[model samples]
Target: MSFNNLKSSIGQALQGLSESVSQKTQEMASTWPAYAQVQQRLAQEKLGQITDISQMPREYIDLEDRIDNLQNSIQVLLHVTRVYEEPAYDWPYSTQESVQDWSRAIGSRVQELSRASSASEAGNLLKSPVGPENGPRTLNYALSQASLAVSTLTSSNMPGPNGEGLSSGLIAYSDTQAKLAQIRIAQDTQVQTKFNKQLREILNNPIAKANKYRKDVQYKRVLYDIARTNLQNARPEKEASLRVEMETLEDQFAQITEEATIVMQETLSNTHLLKNVAELAEIQKNYYKQSLELMNDLMPVFNTAKGDDEDFEIDAKKDPLAAKKVVDDDE
Candidate 1:
């Protein structure tokens, strides 16, 4: 039989024993009323019988064990568990639409700057401001024009172009140099010289010259940072152009550093290039355009002018004789 059926049978047998004991105790109390000792003894016997009935479940110990095993198996099944990891791209961890929007906006700004650079280079846009309000007007119009021009390119391609353009800022072109100079004047000079004088004075009261130098350096740091940011956000084609500009800037930086090193050789025996330590270091940098040009074309024009200049100088000493011969020949 099943464990449950066995347990039920034991319980029913115990109940029947209890009822029989109670009925016998009642009969003895009624029939042997006169004998107090007999009545007391019968009550004691009934108590023992009830205790035995309660303990009768122990007689079916194997059935109890079977019941326990069934219970344990059910508990084991309940204890078994399954776990799973939630998605990583859930609300708090996932990227937002705003991030993409800002990236696009920054890309658009870079495209605008590239167009402006191209327009200025092509002589389509005027270089200098015509009036006090002209700067903003020109900038806005140039940005609008750039948007119109770059509208053909899809949105997905924007980041790639931007990264490539920023890479190109490593190029050093003449136009980039001009723009960098302009950026310095427009952004750096005023803040360092006029705005931060009180701070400089507080920092070093007696060293006016040193204070001014520190302030200038700090200002340049800010301007270079902005330039680097602009280049980083620029488009790939523009980045290529920027690469040319970067080279030019590097050459200029090298020349300046060389001069500085010569001047401060005694004071700074190990003087290195300032551009290396300068803030937004990659921003004010450029690629070697002449080297690139040389790779593309090997012509006499690219030859060293030193020997030719020397030959010209030597021939210049015989100019009087040559001129006399020319006059005689003409006659």
Candidate 2:
């Protein structure tokens, strides 16, 4: 850069710095009196000596209290509802095996079984049962493992005449349970997206902005009060200027108080909160309704198995010798 340009740039920088300092000084000077007045007012309030202070409207005060209660309730809801954010809360346990390892293990086992010529050979190919130690610790996962184990044993001629039927029933049960687990996860996702997300937006945006306005109203109120006190105590020569200052402060305070009141009212009347709550209820309702339907569909299988067991028990009770003969033949 040329010398003249360099000097001009330096001069401009110095001017900007000087201007910034002056602006900051003015801001501090303007705020210091209000800060001092607020401290004095607080001291007097603590000492029970504040007699003629300005009071906020009763409606405004009531709205403020309601907003406070709403914020508190939202905080509590968020505390519990945060569990929806975690996909694994229902089945928190993790296996030591990676996804690839689990997949390969199952694939190799299936391949070995496919090559077996007979049920006896397939049974021999079957290894020890895989369980929660190698998979998620969920009821559906456990049921699936149980189904696999029963199928293995049934194929080996260990369970006898009813083996195939039992295996088929267990597989159906496990499949239905897996579907129910997916539905549950869907419900959690809906709650997180519709309910929890709305609550956080309300708390962070409108509620937060309203709270900031309330603080500004309070600061302006203190400044107004201090200006009024100064005006009252002013000498005759300074009375005119102090009265003007008092009125300006009063106007500023009133404006902010009105704005804060409007914000609080709007926050309280937010219909989105109602909609969010209804969404949560709807999510829960659908989850329960679907689960009930799935369970009811499997009820006949359970009842049939139970009825067969009951008939066998009744026959055993009616003729102990015949039951013993059957048992001996099976053995």
Candidate 3:
């Protein structure tokens, strides 16, 4: 760069630095008095001299308290509603492995067992390398497993009454339970998406924004009060400037207070809360209705089985000797 250009650039940089420092110094000077005044007010409050500090309008104070209560209620609701987001809350055990891992391990073990050459090798292979700990521990999963075991054990080429009724009933029960589990999962999803999600949006958005405005109003009120106090105690020579500062702070406080009031009013009047509550009620109603229907459908099968057992007991009582002979043969 040429010498003249370099000097001009340096002069411009220095001017900018000087302007920035002056701006910062002015800001600090303006802020320090307000900070001191706020501290003085707090000290007076602690000493039970609250009358010296300015009081907010009764309506504004009431609004603040109501907003606080609303926020606390929302927090409590969110805490409980979060459970709906976790569909596996009622699962019997924690999942230690993914489904794919369990499936792969079981498949590999079975394949190894199938290739065993001798009885000793087969026996060793028969020992499970992975336990049921890796499998889903949901009630539906347990029921399904039970159904599979019963079906496997009772399966036969020859048709007979032995084990047939029990296998059929158990399989049907498991199927019904599986359907109920699906419905429960659907309910949880709906609650999480439609109810809890909306609540969170309300709490995080309008409610939170209103609270922020409330804080801004509070800060501005403190500044206004401080400026007023300064103006009241000012010497004759400083009175005019102090009065001007107090008026400016008063206007700022009023504007922020108005904004905060509007925000709080809107937050309190929000219709989304009612909508979310209705959605939750609807989801729960559907869940219970479906569950009741499934249970009703399953009842007849078990009732018939119960009746058959009662008939056998009545027949046994009618022929006690024959019943004893059969029992002895079974033993």
- Evaluated with lDDT, which candidate comes out highest? 2
lDDT of 2 by residue, 15-59 (tens): 999999999999999988768879889788779887767999999
| Candidate 1 displacement at residue 144 in angstroms | 84
Q: Model 2 misses residue 87 by how many Å?
A: 3.0
For model 1, what is the error of residue 238's alpha carbon versus the real structure, in angstroms, after optimal superposition?
0.9
Best by TM-score: 3
Model 1 poorest 10 in a row by lDDT: 81-90
Backbone clash pairs for candidate 2 read none
lDDT of each: 0.38, 0.77, 0.75
Residue pairs in collision within model 3:
none
Per-model TM values vs. the true structure:
0.15, 0.67, 0.69
lDDT of 3 by residue, 1-331 (tens): 9999999999999999999999999999998977887777767777997666667788888888888887787688889889877656676353543465577778878888889889899887776467434333456655766686666676553145546666676778878877877888788889888888888888899889988998788778777877787788899999999999999988999899988998888888873555677788999999998987787666556545532234223244565544554576589
Q: What's the lDDT for candidate 1? A: 0.38
Task: Name model 1 segments beyond 4 Å from true.
Answer: 1-206, 244-331
| Candidate 2 Cα misplacement greater than 4 A, ranges | 1-33, 36-40, 43-51, 91-159, 235-237, 305-331
Off by over 4 Å in 3: 1-50, 96-138, 150-160, 306-331
Model 1: residue 12 alpha-carbon error in angstroms: 99
lDDT for model 2 = 0.77
Question: Sort by lDDT, best first: what order?
Answer: 2, 3, 1
Measured with C-alpha atoms, the lDDT of residue 202 in candidate 2 is: 90
